[model samples]
Target: MTAGERTGEKKDQCQGTGDINFKDRIASSPCVFTIGVAGDSGSGKTTFTQSIRDIFGEDLVTTITLDDYHLYDREERKVRQITPLHPEANRLDQLEHDLVELKEGHTIEKPVYNHATGRFDPPIRFSPGKILILEGLHTLFTPTLREHLDFTLFVEPDPEVKIEWKIRRDINKRGYTREQVMAELGPREEDYQRFIAPQQQYADVVVRVRFSKYGRERGTQDKVYQVSLSQNKITQSIEDVDLSIDLFSLLSLSDRNFLIEFSHEQRNTERSGELIFDGELSARMVERLEQSIEDQTQVRPISVFHNRGHVTATEVVQLILAWRIIHQRVFLERCHHLDQIQG
Candidate 1:
């Protein structure tokens, strides 16, 4: 199967319903739940965000790409001999300001970064939705920006996988030659290590993708992915839904060879729980678990995802992340209420 097949294609379906108390609370108050997704270019950050989008329909979710904050266009970066991965190449200050504005349910004129031309387009008046997702290189890089985000995620793909994804994307989507893509890697990696990698420490969750060891032993390494989601221990206190996987049920019903590993570990000097999943997964099992999630959260299934009828390790990660986001929304609401009472 192709990569698209693994992740599943989008299906046209109606939205799902959930406990409307939180939704109504937000609608009345007009607060935005901000999420920050940080990753190197082509690290599958877009794909990761799409999973969250699937959980909440388009009407409630809005996305902003951080590339729009680039301080210099492609030619300018080349002239300056600076990589876009460097903090100086991006207007992080403007990003912090925009994030604050969005969090306060205010509209802002946002810039647009055109990948095809490696330049920016005219600014557009952008409005904040109920849930605003800010994704880019330095999203979680600074303390000020992190303060604005309700939840933060970082995506780190293995070096080889990142190179493969980047080369394919820059050449196919961004109008770059093979030689140009290869030549830029040296400086980009240097800047990435210095500026981007350290931001992982601030993330509430970190996703690392690499070649599947099981697939490697079976000589299918290129096609299978091993994805590890490392979640910060601090976020555990607010978990409102049960996320335990029924391993017994999964093992009995699934025919595919797979590996699942769970561990408590320290990532960047922070306590975190990491779960790794690889190989083909059981679709029915995942769907059942999703239903359980909705049941506990007291939300009706969003028809878009409920009707998709396909499952992979990717979808599982998305479901968990979506659940976290929903509860984070609730948690924020409670905090707001508490502050009002105290005041």
Candidate 2:
């Protein structure tokens, strides 16, 4: 039962994130949206989602990583001469089914893929929350999956930077040796070319993370995050964006060169909106941007961890997503109120 149902609270319309069956409260819970973030491995998907959990609170959002759908264990994939990136390697149909059920206000026992043991563990059962986040490489690869998302964010870290990040993460965090990391990258690139990067064409937002060459031409790798907003899907106009700097640039990707948009409204002393930053960044800037006015109704600062001197590219991307998620929520909530009053 929903939290409101158990406590007998008069649950009126809300931006969701409450314990309520979404289907039963569809009219009051139009903001119960699903977000899909897709990219190749080590593109900071886990880090980004972790930051959201910190900000929105652990119980507000339900996150599902598509990687756990691997049909074969590591040894099984090796024996079959197949990599996990291939569509055949994953149980996507099941993933779609569970997401559909979750969308309709049902619980699901999601599968768990254990990387260290190269095997499948028991499934973890859970109910859906106000927001559902579905992330993986092939999330947009399939039409069925794409149709289910309210917002799609494609993470594009620079090739060189991604490799560096992958090596560090796999070896240091995942217990993989240097040699294993290299071997994995080659097959991953092949898989990406075949199945991953192509999905970016359908994304509503493409988060491009690159080690900025503008940073003093030094040996250091301070990064810049260019969050390109696709004007086609989002309802917000460029005129409405309140970013300060007029620094504008255009770039092409996915067979369409999307115009980069920028603006920032003052949100807690920091510029909040689709804006650009190319130099050193502070963790506090990220926190302030997240708890912006657009979504401050449900806003709370995410606990931040950074290096002594600067914030990492991964951290910045998380804040970018948090910005998008919160803004989308606020927009929907207001729109729904207007619709109800008219009705």
Candidate 3:
């Protein structure tokens, strides 16, 4: 019997008091929504989660990197000559245990993997919250891990775009030479296709940041693309924002548009909110929202576009809160439906 049924509270039980109700009981517990971002090494998975963290705020959400679950450090793996992309490179069983603890709303001491030092750092204890954003190379690869997630996201950029990002990120952040990065890329390509790419089929959403021909083509400019699969198979192109200054420049804008549309379509059928901001009230609200977001996220909202573009850190937090509200309503609706059926 599940925990709810074992509590012996008929009203609290999700399933009716019957012999065949055990399955229903397991299905109706308070759900933890998990979003997994899986992609190539430099396909912006970490960057994507940072944006999500900013929007959700640390109070309501927690993020865990799958890198922390690595079984061996870089030096050890190199000594063994085992590629990090392989399944054996990680402690999959421990990861499964961590997920179970999170599902139960219990705290866990998460291991810290330091890429620069090539080892595991001190264990950081954290309690799972309403939303959990997990990102890394093999986040979606394991079937057991995949089943626990409420939503799965795949970040796939064009190969050329990813290579450029990998080079820049490795050189600047990981202290890898351009030649070393290039050499590792070829060896990892097969592993990525074998293990990572296959997970995309199970994804509820696939986010692609692609370069499109628009105004003056200075270089490769990325436009955010979001595909939602829960309510409807809708594909949207988020407005093109400049990616020169920072990687997260366009993430909030894309997330805002997606959440607004998704919530409107699911909850209120009224199309009252404007998709694009233009007028004075909208502009003022944007300014106030930006200020609020900055107060929460501790990051300055950099200007990332031309033509009267203004997005603040506070607005991003508001967008995430709005998404949480919508998600909670959906959860409650499901609970009500289950209660009625049990009755």
Candidate 4:
């Protein structure tokens, strides 16, 4: 299995999960829905999770960043000469146990990795919620933990873009210098190849962020993070179809898979551009979805998410994740129904 590839096996096909009947599991504990998200450093893991935290509202969703499960604090990692990417550097078994417990609607005192102090802060309480986003580098990498996740997401960005994000974030936010950022990246590279990238094969949804190569690519320094999406064939609704209509005009790809361009880049000479979700999409769509979510969930979002009246990749991806989590019963039923029809 590799990045951008689905495991190609159904949950029923996997061993040790007990049974393939998610409905029974849902019935047993309907309150908790967990999504396991994995991506390399600076690949928009936190940004995407933040978007979800906002859309679902903090009260309804809980995010457990697996970085908190690091076996060694930052200083310890440095002293041991180990990067955070290695399996040896993390408490994988404990992470798996915590996720299993969360799925069963249990609370946990999850560790807090303090980047500023290079140590573990006092653990924070994680009460179970309707939705849980487990976001980090090795999130979907562990098989046992993967089983407990209802949705699995993987994000991989263009190499240059990823490096730029990592460098900027480490220096500005995580208290590191440019030289230190560069130094640690080399050490982490091997672990990334072995642990991080391989998890993508298990991802139910894969989002690739890159410079628009075949189509529009222009973006300012801050907002250039365009996204490409692929997924296991999903059970989409009328709302999903309408959402697709909203993403691209003169679209090249299906609604389920499209590229979001951050700037106003026009189509090429071929007239057959790659599926582009340029920033110039309609505003009504966001409003429509916002209203739909409010209607369904009985809680309106704080405000419609947009940048200068243009819809963003970050915002739309948040909607897609919301669609998956909020109507998970619909998604799961439709999938099984489709399977029965096909079988």
Would you estimate the TM-scores of all the predictions?
Answer: 0.85, 0.71, 0.62, 0.74
- Greater lDDT among 1 and 3 belongs to 1
- Model 2: ten consecutive residues of lowest lDDT: 1-10
Model 4, 72: alpha-carbon shift in Å?
1.4
lDDT of 1 by residue, 24-121 (tens): 45556677888889999889887777855775558778999999999999999999999989999999999989888898988999999999888899
338 in model 1: Cα distance from truth in Å?
A: 3.6
Q: Can you list the residue pairs that collide in candidate 1? A: 16-301, 16-302, 17-300, 18-299
| lDDT tens digits by residue: candidate 3, 1-343 | 2111212233343322222222133234355556666777788775545544554457656788788998999888878876677778888889888998897778998999997887889999878766677787787777778777655666776677678778988999988889988978876888888878777665544444443222213123323322122222322211111112222544444333222223333312222221221111122234443443333223355221124443322233224333322233233334556777878
Please give the lDDT score for candidate 3. Answer: 0.54
What is the RMSD, in Å, between candidate 3 and the native fold over all Cα? 11.8
**Candidate 2 vs candidate 3: which has greater lDDT?**
2
TM-score of 2: 0.71
Q: Which stretches of candidate 4 lie above 4 Å from their native place?
A: 1-30, 212-222, 235-240, 244-276, 285-303, 306-308, 329-343
Q: Cα deviation in Å at residue 13, candidate 3?
A: 18
The lDDT leader among the candidates is: 1
Question: 141-190, model 2: which lDDT tens digit per residue?
Answer: 77777777766777777787689878988888777899988987888899
Q: What is the descending lDDT order?
A: 1, 4, 2, 3
Deviating ranges (above 4 Å) for candidate 3: 1-31, 47-52, 215-343
Q: Tell me model 2's lDDT, rounded to 2 decimals.
A: 0.61
lDDT of 1: 0.74
- Per-residue lDDT value at 224 in model 2: 46
